[model samples]
Target: MKPVEIAKGVYDVGVIDWNIRDFHGYSTHLGTSYNAFLIVDEKIALIDTVKKGFAEQLLRNISTIIDPGKIDMVISNHTEMDHSGSLPYIMDKIGIQKPLYCSKMGEKNLSRHFSSDLNYQVLKEGDEISLGSKTLTFIETRMLHWPDSMFTYLKEDKILFSSDAFGQHYAGHEEFDDVVGNKIMFHAQKYYANILLLYAPLILKLVEKITKAGLEFNIICPDHGVLWRNPGRIIEAYAKWSKQEDCADKAVIVYDTMWDSTHQMALAVADGLHENGIDVRPMKLRDWDRSDIMTEVLDAKAVIIGSPTLNNGIFPTIADFITYMKGLKPKNKIGAAFGSFGWSGESVKIIEQNLGEMNFDLPVSGLKIPFVPDNNGLEKCREFGSQLAKAIKG
Candidate 1:
């Protein structure tokens, strides 16, 4: 992508990856962008860089506006390879002597990725740097996802160069929020569910810190996806998501079946939830990706998982989903387990145990069938669903 001016003299000189399907195991079906910004002032500064393999594309984009060598300083917002993978190459090409500004942890992290002798200028929160008409203020966002993350604010322009706070893994041509409209929010939700859900508490604290500091922005330029031209839109969205309290009056039934018995049980449970006036989504493991399922779990008040026993243990796919979900640490959820077993009925007990470990409100003892569930067994599953719905309502 060529350099596009975001504001008066600021340009978004970033590279778009239109074919990347997987990002460190998180499915990026919509691809993504490694965004960097360039400011033209008395002292020109480049904020962030693209991934390592796309260094040429980044440099080409920069060339469209001005020679990259003329850039007086470089800012490292996050040391993640996707954002800072081209740091060494850019620094080498544009005089390694130029100062690279970053947070204290960024200095340590980047030095490990590149040569240790490169120029590194560390700045703390509230530090300011002047570039003629525009001034940049630093805000340290420790563990907003990474320890090295920080945001740069253009005081005069009222723009916040947020590193990764409100980013989405969407590779759309539209660079502004209003142009993309509501569709951008779905991508943002998926991004938050898959990437930032585990850090919800830290995100809440960061949002409160920024608000208390009285920082205002006309635009929020993140290191990925589109810029938030409607500044308050994403901030409001993040604030809601970080609280983890605004869940839909819905339930997600996630399961995998060996012989369709578990699938039938899942459907029965869905019927019960529907009867209770709760929105229900039944996802067979084969038909849904784990990341997509996790996104569904984000706004769901309850998660009901079913699995057929295999090798005297839960289905591998269900095991994988449980591991992934547990790591994400979703809170304020009610959970229940149901499944069919040929001999030992251990899967339901195992699921219930895991959910209890995660601190979910478990109201039922879980339902288990010895073989293909009979009509009576299915009714029991429905009753289990009704119990979960009641818990959600309460």
Candidate 2:
């Protein structure tokens, strides 16, 4: 894949990461792209940079269209090494005299990560820069997943150059809607749930600002994944994601069963969900990867998390899962609880309490079973599933 012609003067000089395995801390199960854009005008600009290993390929790709020394401005949207890992190398090849632009926080972060001397010109919210006929506007979107992140707007073309806001880890030959079917939607939602769920508050604020600013963006050139020429799809998807809504019209049941009684209950719950025309994906906590569960949770309208009692508390693995989720603070998931306990039923209560602390700001109803899932216990589990489905429907 060579450089993609995104617009008349704007080109996608981004690198396709088909072989790369990991991203940030999450497993890039399907691989991801480190998208960088090149805009040529009276002065040339490069938005974002590829991963460290891809610096040579990135530079070669740029040379195919224009000279590397001609790049007058380089935009660093986020200081995270994935988006800026190749900055130092690229700057060395392209010369250091060019002006580098980023937010103040981004500047501080970049200095901390690389060398202190590599400071950049700081741009704040509503700042604008000109490149011949087209003007670029900066919107401060701090914590839209990162503290120093910001998006650049192409004023003349109505194209929003988003760094990672609308990115996906999906790598494929397809570029737009006509290429793939609904797989794009699935991959996009998975990326949002695992990556952007924690920054939902800031996401809502950013969307509102974009709307209030009255910017007519005909295209969204994100740093990764496919470009959105049908602006409505990405915008509507962002609106729904900002609100924390799932798309599968399904439910997810995740449980860690010690004996096998709890596992049976989880399957029963899945059955209830299926009978009601709701698709269900059940996973044993020990057998399933957190990232996979996270992807399912992203699209699930309902979620059921459970664990068997262990030594007066919840299962240690489940406790770890809850702790991981606590920092993540995934939103827009309506959930329920189910677990089996011996003499004391502490596991169910513990799971629910942990989820509450994680700030799971969604409708919830909990259920707890005894030491085993007898006829009555299974019935109660089915009832919990029904109630959860009802909550999701509302």
Which model scores highest in TM-score? 1
Give the residue spans of candidate 2 off by over 4 A. 245-249, 299-301, 331-333, 342-344, 358-376, 390-394
Worst 10 residues of 1 by lDDT: 237-246
The lowest-lDDT stretch of 10 consecutive residues in candidate 2 is 357-366
lDDT (0-100) at residue 130 of candidate 2?
A: 94
Estimate, for each residue in 1-394, the C-alpha lDDT of model 1 and write its tens digit: 7789988889999989999999987889999999999999989999999899999999998898889899999999999999999999999888899999999999999999899978999999999999999999999988878899999999988999998889999998899989998989988888899889999988888888989988888999988899998888888888788787968889999999988899999999999998998999999988898998988899999999999888878999999999999999999999999999999988998999999999998987788998898899899888888888888888
Among all candidates shown, the one with the greatest lDDT = 1
Report, for every candidate in turn, its global Cα lDDT versus the true structure.
0.91, 0.80
> In model 1, where do residues sit more than 4 Å from their true spots?
none
TM-score of each: 0.98, 0.90
Residue 382 of model 2 has an lDDT of 79
